[model samples]
Target: MTSLAFLLPIALGMGLCGLAAFFWALKRGQFSDLDGAAARILIDDEEDIHP
Candidate 1:
């Protein structure tokens, strides 16, 4: 149908936009430190301020 013709391009455009955004995040190092963040959460601060 005619609706399919219009929707197909829109879907493809959205997919391409998502791919571009993912690539941009890669270039910006967004996925570079996945493990460090998890480790940071487990780290405990030993500083005692309740003197």
Candidate 2:
């Protein structure tokens, strides 16, 4: 009973912090080019392999 009182607020606070961080990143354009990274991996720009 006493443990619940302590744990619930802690859990909610952590969840809110995570949400805030995500929004901050979003506003800073962190997720602006989501498709760019995925497409880059598919195109291999390999140079010559001369021994």
Candidate 3:
């Protein structure tokens, strides 16, 4: 009972922090190029590098 009083605000605060971080990432374009990154990894640029 007493623990809930202390822990509830902490839990809510942490959840809000996570939500804010997610929104911040959205504003920063962190999730803008999801598919491009995945496809880029499969691309081979070996010809551009000369040994």
Cα TM-score per model: 0.82, 0.85, 0.84
lDDT of each prediction vs. the true structure?
Answer: 0.94, 0.93, 0.97
Ranking by lDDT: 3, 1, 2
TM-score of the candidate numbered 2?
A: 0.85
State each model's C-alpha RMSD to the native.
2.3, 1.8, 1.8
Q: Write the per-residue lDDT of candidate 3 for residues 1-51, one digit (tens) a residue.
A: 999999999999999999999999999999999999999989989888866
Candidate 1 backbone collisions, by pair? none
Worst 10 residues of 3 by lDDT: 42-51
**In model 3, what lDDT does residue 31 have?**
100
What is the lDDT, from 0 to 100, of the residue 10 in candidate 1? Answer: 100
Which candidate number has the best lDDT?
Answer: 3
What TM-score should be assigned to candidate 3? 0.84
**C-alpha lDDT of residue 50 in model 1:** 54
- Is candidate 2 or 3 superior in lDDT? 3
Q: Distance from true position, residue 49, model 2, in Å?
A: 4.7
Off by over 4 Å in 1: 46-51
Model 1, residue 9: displacement in angstroms? 0.2
Which ranges in model 2 have alpha carbons more than 4 Å from their true place?
A: 48-51
